[model samples]
Target: MEKTYLRAVEVDQWQTRQDITVTIPDSFDREVMASLPSLPDEPEKAVEWSGMLEMIGNASGVLWQKDAEVESLKTQIEIQKKAMLDECQGLQAELKEARDETHRANAAAALATNRAIKAEAWLQQVKEALASGFAPHLGRAPVERPSVLLAR
Candidate 1:
């Protein structure tokens, strides 16, 4: 059967390379490498498609390497996605805690403001009572005092 894939090259022909190294699970760094036949090296014999059939097996080997690289990339993507999800969850929890703390602080400030208003009202009432008590005697004569009570 003819191959569905085209030629795979050394270090792969993919223009974009991965920034992170991916080690596929269950693959302990074992791989196969092969070079396909090219133009005549010595120029002694001219052979075209006659012997190109032998390179089919080599092509399949290279194809496996490409497949492994693709699989590794997929695994890395999944891992990064999961990590981002976890970080988001943690940030959400922190945000919730900060909101709760803000609410509590606002409540405390309101309570303190109400208490200050009540204290100020009490102080004003005391001042009014003192002023009124002293004002009644402003125009009255001084009351006579007994000699016995003033002697001490």
Candidate 2:
């Protein structure tokens, strides 16, 4: 069995009309001729496939160009997809870092709150000590003294 490499191609319906000519492979030409009946130079009845003939006349070397353009666009789409994925990953990483920082800030705030509570208790003790008038030689509390407000 003989194998022929053939690629199925699609072309844009819009084609140029510059009177370009093309030659098909001999085997393909022979096969087409053998399979289909030949059209007469002049026919009495209207041809069924005459429209297809006119369209084919404009599609000789233009299909490859459109095909290449399609391929290039597909490549660009893939590149854009990769870049978007990378950007998403970067954003996710940034979110994780922000969450970590938030947790650290919350921890620091809790520690500060605890220190403030302890400091408030210590300040209360100091106020009591001051009221008692800490005099080591005298006593914890002095006898009832005259009011300075009355003296004034």
Candidate 3:
């Protein structure tokens, strides 16, 4: 059995690309390589394994807090979206109601105009009958004839 140590180096400035060469204890490297998994990209797998351990140990709480915040924001956005949709529906209903009222008012006005036309026709018929001294047979007396003969 052998012991292996992990090391990481920091850079002072950003670089376009960076490569690291790791130096391992001679006996530790030989032992670790012998027990390695049979993966095609063993180097990348080794790096991922090291990262997983570090994340579990140090960054779990930070990741959990960020996830919770994101969920809270999503819930608030959904609530706001629903509120906006409800308001739009209410406005649409009000507009439809107003249109219905306008249609009813227009129909009433048309009916009133038709009634006025019929009343005017009746008045003209009555004027002609009075001028000609015509009386109905329904027990109604004749209307007074115009007084052109009164001067005689």
Candidate 4:
């Protein structure tokens, strides 16, 4: 049997691990490798490493919770955006209906105006024929009696 000495040293800026150099009999090397110590012997380094691993776990948990919240908020935002788009489409349809109604009303108004103009023209022609004492030169048939005389 041979004696082995292992030392723990800090690695990088934030980590500590064992640094060991050993010469052992071939038969004992396999046993030594199988039963190597997992933790540093120094109490302060062990405590620090344990606390750091715990902090990392806590931070990872917080990050996962925050990610879940972010996803929930994104889903809510998508729902709101869809609702707003539906509302906008509805409003657009309503506006188009109103515009179509206005166009129909305008067309009806134009027709009525044209009819009124034609009525006025016809009335003026009739008045002129009466004032001219039933002129035969007009396109109408000659009247044998005046309209007023016939009315009486």
Please tell me which predicted candidate would have the highest lDDT against the true structure: 4
Ranking by lDDT: 4, 3, 2, 1
lDDT of 3: 0.63
Candidate 3 residue pairs in backbone clash: none
Per-model root-mean-square deviation over C-alphas: 14.8, 11.4, 14.5, 14.5
Off by over 4 Å in 3: 1-62, 131-152
Segments of candidate 2 deviating more than 4 angstroms: 1-57, 134-152
Clashes of each: 0, 0, 0, 0
lDDT by residue (1-152, candidate 1, tens digit) is 23233344445576643333322322221221113354466656644332353465456657767787998999999999999999999999999999999999999999998887777767766666666666667964444332221111
- Per-candidate TM-scores read 0.51, 0.54, 0.43, 0.53
Which regions of candidate 4 are displaced past 4 Å? 1-44, 47-49, 132-152
Q: Model 3 over residues 19-68: C-alpha lDDT tens digits?
A: 34444344654466567766885556454444454455346446655666
Q: List the residue pairs that clash in candidate 2.
A: none
| Global local distance difference test of model 1 | 0.60
lDDT of 2 by residue, 1-152 (tens): 23223333434558532333344444654565467765587556544343444466446335655777898999999999999999999999999999999999999999998887777767766665666575545665543433232110
lDDT values for all models: 0.60, 0.62, 0.63, 0.65
Q: Residue 99, candidate 1: how far off, in angstroms?
A: 1.3
For residue 30, model 3's alpha carbon misses the true position, in angstroms, by 26
Better of 1 and 4 by TM-score: 4
lDDT of 2: 0.62
